[model samples]
Target: MPSLRIACFHLNQLGDLVFSLPALLALGRGFPKAQIISVARPPHRELLLLSGLVHNVVERPRGQLISKLKMVSALRSMKLDLAVLFSTSLGTAILAWMAHPREKAGFGKRGLAYRAEKIGPPSVANNLRLVEALGCRVEKRDYVGLVKLDESVRCRVRDLLMHAGIGESTPYAVISPAASGRRAIKEWTSEGFAAVAERLADDLDLVPVLVGTEADEVVAGLSEKIVDLRGKTSIIELAALLEGAHVFVGIDSGVMHLAAAVGTPVAALFGPTDPAITGPMGEGHKIVQSDVPCLACMKTSCREPLCMQRITPDAVIESVAMCVSEEKNV
Candidate 1:
C-alpha cells in the first residue's frame, strides 16, 4: 500500500529474460513508486540494469545453499510486499516462500503452496498475471522491447559498421549461427548457411554480417564474403548492429531475440524447438522450419538431427528475401 517494495525472480537465460520484459514493464508501470528488484543470473545483470524495468539487479547464486539463504534473507530484510517468481524452478519458488512476502505468485504447483492462484499464460504474459493479481493496472503491450540504446553506443556501432566496410546506407542482413553447447541440435548446418549467404549476396544485393561469440567460429567458413564479427562485439554492441540491419537470419538463439526486440525483420530458422512459442513474436518475423513431426521435440542431444537438416537453405533464403522486401516496401 504505502511505498510498495517488490522482488521478481528470473534466473533464466537471455531469451527467456527478454520474453518477460512486457510483464515486467507492465508491473513497473502499475507501481511507479515501488522499487522493482530483479533477482537474476549474473549474466543478465547488464540487461536487467539497462532495461529500466527494475530498479535493482541481484544475482541468484548458482547451486549454493548459503548463498541462496543470503539472497532470500536479503529480500526479507527489504520488507518486500510482493515476490513474483518468474522462474518455474523449485529453488526459486522455495526462495520466494522463504522471503515471506505479503503476496507471492508464480506458475506451477510448487508456487501454489505460497500463493493460492497459479499464474497462467504463455512465457511472455505469465508474470503479468501476477501483477494483475495484486490489483495493478496492466496494459497490453504489443512488444516487450526493454533495452534503450544510448546515442554514444549508436556512434560506436556506426564506427564498427564503417570498419566492417558496411556503408551508412548499405542494407545488410545479420546472421547468427551459434547456440548454447547443450542446444546444438537447434542449429542449422554450416553448408546450409553458406548457401544462404551466397543467395543474400547474389539475389538480394545485401551484405551478410555474422553475429556471435567466437564460438561461432565453427560456422565462420560458411562463406568467405561474410563479415565475421564474432567475439568482436559486446552484447549491447551486437544489439546495436542487429538494430540497424534490415533483416536478421538466425536460429532460435538469444541473438535472434535481441534482433527481434530491436524491431528488425527476422527470418528465424526453427528446428528442434517449437516456433509457435519460442519463435520471434510481433510483426515482420517469419519462421522457416521443416515439416518434421518430431521437429518440436525439444531434444538437447540427438544422434541424427533430421529436423535441422530438413530446413533447407533455399527455404531460409526465401524467408529472408521476403522479409527484406517487405521492409523495403515499408
Candidate 2:
C-alpha cells in the first residue's frame, strides 16, 4: 500500500501557528507513517520546517491571483490523501477544496468531511478539537511546546549575543512593547516599560533586551541598559533568545506566546484582549491587567484605553519579580 500523504493548511501569524502545534502533534500521533506537508507563508514556513513536525512545507501564495492559481496546480499534482485546514479563511477553504483531498478536516461547515466548532476553549485547546474530530487522542503535555531548535541554532544565537556585548553567562529579560496592526490600545505606555526595565536591572539584576520586528521598535531609546534587538533577530533566532531569558515582559502579542512556547516565564500585560482566550499557555505566566469594566472588549481603537493606562508599572514589576522567584523555585 502507498504511504498516506497529508497536507495541513496552516494559520498565517506566528502565534496562531504556534497555537495550532498541538493539533498538528495529534495528526502525527494518529498517522505515524504518514508524510505530512504544510502549506504556510514565509518565515513561518521556515519555522515549521525546523519544528520537525511536518515532513515538508509548501509556500502559500500571496498578493497575486496568478501565484495562487499556480499553488493550486501544484497541490492538485500532489494528489493529497488528507487535507487539514488550520485557517478558517474562505481562500484557504477554496484552496483545500480545489486540491481534491480524499478526506478533509477543518472548522465550521465549510463542506469538509470532518468539522469542529471553531469556538470554545483557549486557542490552543480549540485547535485540538479539530484533530479530535478525526479520532486523534490529544495528549495533555503536547500543548506546552513551540519548536525544537538544533545545537547550531543555539550556537548562532549565542554568537549573536556575544556580538551584542552580552556574555554567555549573562541573564537577560526580553521585553516587547509593540502589538500588531492598529491595536495601539493593547500596548502599555513607554514610560511604564522603561520603569519596568529599570526595576529588572536594579531589583532583579537581569539585563533588559528589547525584541520585535523593525516595525515594532516602539520601545527603543528607553534605556542604555536595554539591548535593542528589535528588527535584528529572525523568528527562530528570537525563539532562541526567549529560551535563554530569565523572563519576558510584553503586551498581548505573538512574541509573548513565543516566550511561553520556549518555556520562558512571561510577565504579560493584558488590556483589551481576554487572557483566558488568547493568553500564554503552560505554567509560570504572570498576567498584569487592571480591573476595568471593559477589560476584554477586544477593541482595536480606544482614545483613552483606560484598561492599559490603569496598569501601573509597579504592578508589572511585582509580576516580574514573582515570575523570577517562581522560576528559581522550580
**Candidate closest to the true structure, highest lDDT:** 2
- Give the clash count for each candidate: 0, 0
Per-residue lDDT of model 2, residues 155-264, tens digit only: 98899899888899999999998887656789888878888888899999999998876755545666767888887778888899999999999999888988898899
Error of 2 at 189 (Å): 1.6
How do the predictions measure up, each by TM-score?
0.87, 0.94
- Window of ten residues with lowest summed lDDT in model 2: 140-149
lDDT of 2 at 23: 81
lDDT (Cα, tens digit) per residue for candidate 1, span 207-300: 8898777777766776777988777776777778888998999999878888888889999988877777677876888899888788888777
Error of 2 at 132 (Å): 0.6
Alpha-carbon RMSD to native, per candidate: 2.9, 1.8
